[model samples]
Target: MVADAIYSCLPDPKEISPVETAPDPEDYQFLAVGFWVDKGTADQKAREYMTKIRNKKIGVFGTLGAYPDSDHANTVRERVRELLKENDIMDLFLCQGKVDPELVKMMAETMKDDPHHSMTPERRARLKEAEKHPDEDDLKNAQKVFEQIMVSLNN
Candidate 1:
């Protein structure tokens, strides 16, 4: 969805696609980076790439099961911005994405008899809260952010 939004705003989006692996800085004037939030910041792959970048224009975006303006999201954004301090961080956007209840359950399962995954009341409640995510509003907000990034890039 983020990609589609960026492409929609670009004059020739078909000819442009974001790089998955770290890209050569000389190849593009602008870059749109998207990632899934892991822990308190970007996933490992994204962190690696962001750290490698220097003196380039970058837009960072991510999706997680938290509100766009939530404390968790804010911390993640701060961490990401720090990584891009040496570069020109054009913008950033965060939005909730569907966090499957099953996936959460499985993750908890992996914790396997651990105190946090023991089907405890607290854990169950947390799971329930997490289950309510990635709704329509999140997608719409993310798309809007992507469009804004495109506009920022153009300027």
Candidate 2:
């Protein structure tokens, strides 16, 4: 499994399974976590671990990514924002020792008001549908509208 391989590669590797829940941020300096491209067993397993971590009131969680520019990466980052807001937990998301600048900008832009975001008609329709739901899943559903526009104009 990807989680097993990552743990094997880590310096202080621990055999963490989804069944084992994590403690709160108050209990630890950081809640280290991982994800995989294959969302079958890997994704389900990771979510179990994250759910346990979230239940502990631990807001600080880290995610290591293979592709930083992938939509899944964007989804994870956006999901973290929704988690923080929902849990009433204030903490930083660190990829390593340093924070991700793109994520920071995304969070900031999300908090601010903007009118001229480049939303295509189809995307707008999806956003409208997401607005109807207004849940964590919906947040994930509609992030492309924000994520695409939030990227550098140079691209």
Candidate 3:
């Protein structure tokens, strides 16, 4: 969704999703990379693409499970930024992404019997406190952020 917005803003955008293959920097002067956060950083494929990019104009965007402004999210952002190397990282657009609740439930069930499971009072409270997020505002804001980066880069 974010990529679609960024692509629309561009004079000519070649839409591609980097998965098993990374876009060759030689094919384009500028690149927009988007990925989902995993364990406080870009997932493995995105990280692979990031390392391959060097000395190019780059726009970064992604989604995360954590609220955009939370400390955990901020720390993840910092770690995400670290993914850039030898490139001009123009900007980052972050938004909350839906995580599979089934995964969470599975974890809870699987760890319920684990001796090492730390279902501390605090952890339990935090889990309960987390609410459904990434409303329309988050999606809109992410698109806006990507558009702004495109405008700035064009200038």
List TM-scores for all candidates, in order: 0.72, 0.30, 0.78
Q: Write the per-residue lDDT of candidate 2 for residues 1-155, one digit (tens) a residue.
A: 32333344333423354434544435543333544323211345555555545333322333332233446556666665554443434332322112245743574467445444334454345344433333343233233322332232225
Query: What's the true lDDT of residue 60 in model 3?
Result: 84
**Whole-model lDDT values for every prediction:** 0.70, 0.39, 0.73
> Which 10 consecutive residues of model 3 have the lowest summed lDDT?
125-134
**Model 3, span 8-104: residue lDDT tens:** 6666646566456655776888888888888888998888878888888888888776667788788877887777857888888787766677866
Task: Say which prediction, candidate 2 or candidate 3, comes out ahead on lDDT.
Answer: 3
Task: Give candidate 2's error at residue 70 in angstroms.
Answer: 3.5
What shift in Å separates residue 71 of candidate 2 from its native position after superposition?
A: 3.7
| Clashing residue pairs found in predicted model 3 | none
Candidate order by decreasing TM-score: 3, 1, 2
What is the Cα-based TM-score of model 2? 0.30
Candidate with maximal TM-score: 3
Q: Cα deviation of 84 in candidate 1 (Å)?
A: 1.3
lDDT of 1 by residue, 68-117 (tens): 77777888888989978998887787866656768777876787678644
